[model samples]
Target: MSKEVSEEAEHAPPKDYTDPPPAPLLDVGELRLWSFYRALIAEFVATLLFLYVTIATVIGYKVQSQNDPCGGVGYLGIAWSFGGMIFILVYCTAGISGGHINPAVTFGLFLARKVSLLRALTYMVAQCLGAICGVGIVKGIMKHPYNSLGGGVNEVASGYSKGTALGAEIIGTFILVYTVFSATDPKRKARDSHVPVLAPLPIGFAVFMVHLATIPITGTGINPARSLGPAVIYNNRKAWDDQWIFWVGPFLGALAAAAYHQYILRAAAIKALGSFRSNTRN
Candidate 1:
């Protein structure tokens, strides 16, 4: 009987409802290694490239649209530029750094127990620095045009209230961070997670769709670093005035998403299922 029980246990399927091991709040072990540095470098370069391409596209489009609204790529094209760049950059750097080019995404993942505090903080710093450098490069090359076109700084559009603008940013970031959590959930089947083409598309699409919805309201600042880069470089009072919305809205949205996905959607379902199983057994 003992041998039979042992064999049966060995053949049993893995538990269906097990939560992943929670990452420590501060993972000191990760900080002592060269791999950590490599990951940070990847994040820095990816964010830099992302900001450079997107900011230049914004400036270029504005310059081309000079007098005619129909002259340049317009709103839809600008949205695509931001989305497409994120897809490319995420794909390129996902393996090296988890491809968190946005600090909002990092914060969401940190709250969801996907990464440690140290990693989240370091990634945010790298991303912000990268963004600054990226926008600086654009300004350096196209100094006059860049500044003339507002340096691609995000601003609340005319006729919109600050409350409405903040709400737009909050919802936009919620969509983005929610998609990131769903895409990168480790509990996803191995085949799905390992599919080289799967994860980045949804995240990129989220950015694209959110931009389409919120661009006119708050110029679509779902990433605080993206907003800060242009604002810092432009150094305008208007940009500075509404800067808190970009940071506060995205962070709030990210936190809400983490709570919703991790606790309400994931953990609650597991608990309900476990209770159902217990009642059935009883």
Candidate 2:
């Protein structure tokens, strides 16, 4: 029996992946579904927790460093806080809402036809609201320092020009969204089916690496929701002044990543435009 099973496995044909039709442009029926609302809730809660922890860390770091230059968790710790939260939250929410937690990510996936425009827009709204609430909680709890400190708002650092800051955000978000696509690709999934945890680790690492590289430039606004949250709460002129860079840069980055992943790396354009309509998403 073992010999027969081995022979059967050896002779089995390689599985082929066929493309599923793209997600509907507007899945109105989804609004009535409990699962859809559940997913929205998951995204909202995850983002809320993400912003709360990260912004609090930023505020705490600022307060500490003011008194003692070497004190507090420092920039490294702040990056860890953001990345670690992403890893944990993505792991927790991947099943429910794809664990976007970032509007730029949702936009990229939408461009790749992995998500519908409606779902992407709603997810972005929920994420933004969650972020605002998260930062509000931080302000309410740590009123004095939160106000005095910068409220963790992102902005172009003094030495950098707006163009440079925009460039940084664009590249940083491209790295992040590119990692998301690669990590979640069906090909990777099939090849490494035994190691499911691999997805969030690289995603988290990408965030950490981007933060390390660009934190000094634009305070790293790779996620529009992240930049929006603090800017809205802090209501600072400097933060607001540089706000366009966060949105425009991340969005452009996401678009570039999507086009590159779909048209070039995955050869999606060739497949669909050619004889085959191969699967792009699992």
Candidate 3:
């Protein structure tokens, strides 16, 4: 009887195998084409919104003096414009593509395994192109000293050194990436945390905080594209020269945040998943 029972168990089909098999791969060329189109449109609209507010703020500040009849918006006002733009964009499109309005955010997501490498590269290219177009539009609209109007064009102010500027960029980017990782962590979701409510708020405030601290130093370009847009049109050599610091600092900070979030904080969860997979295989 024991032998018969064992044979019956071995011969029976697995209970989980009752479901239908997954569909075979199909011709996905059309799907890919449509996806690309949607992504491009989304990027263009988002970038235009961002640059419009940013450049408008800069122009308003530069052209209208403090003593002018209509007082200009000050530096703090400009900072608020940037933060508010980001908050609106994130709330609008975060569901579609995680609202990576900046390339550094895209790179960080790729490092965290939230986005694929190919997607990351594509998103970066899209972001850069959108930024250029956005600034180009601003140039067309503004009649004043176009070079000086767009938030100083990433140039360091009178007293700030290159090292100091770079330090500010690095520190600002580090804080931004750290906040991003914390806000988007899946474990936080598992714990029923209310991240989505203040997701855009925290990110926008992070930008505001960075600018508040670093505007006097390097104009606080935590996003390379933000610097690149105005710099390209303005023919600003200082902005071009210091562009490397913006890219390198933000990327390095993002990498560090991704590593810390994936390996350090989630090591136990990873081990637990490994054990579960091993048991399933057995």
Q: How many residue pairs clash (N, CA or C atoms closer than 3 angstroms) in each of the candidate models, in the order given?
A: 0, 0, 0
Better of 1 and 3 by TM-score: 1
lDDT of 1 by residue, 147-238 (tens): 88888888899999999999998889999999988887766645364567578898899999999999899889999999999998989999
Candidate 3, residues 37-113: lDDT per residue as tens digits? 57656766787678767876777787886458456777788889888888889778777767788888878877766
Error of 3 at 230 (Å): 0.9
What's the lDDT for candidate 1?
0.88
lDDT sort, best first: 2, 1, 3
lDDT scores for all predictions? Answer: 0.88, 0.89, 0.73
TM-score of 2: 0.91
After superposing candidate 3 on the true structure, give the runs of residues whose Cα lies further than 4 Å from its correct spot: 1-33, 66-70, 148-152, 193-196, 268-282
- TM-scores for all predictions: 0.88, 0.91, 0.80
Q: Which segments of candidate 2 are over 4 A away from where they belong?
A: 1-20, 194-196, 276-282
Who wins the lDDT comparison?
Answer: 2
User: Any residue pairs clashing in model 2, and if so which?
Assistant: none
Can you write out model 2's per-residue Cα lDDT over 29-82, one digit (the tens) per residue? 888999899989999999999999999999999989997999999889999999
The true-structure Cα RMSD of candidate 3 reads 8.3
After superposing candidate 1 on the true structure, give the runs of residues whose Cα lies further than 4 Å from its correct spot. Answer: 1-19, 190-197, 268-282
lDDT, candidate 1, at 40: 98
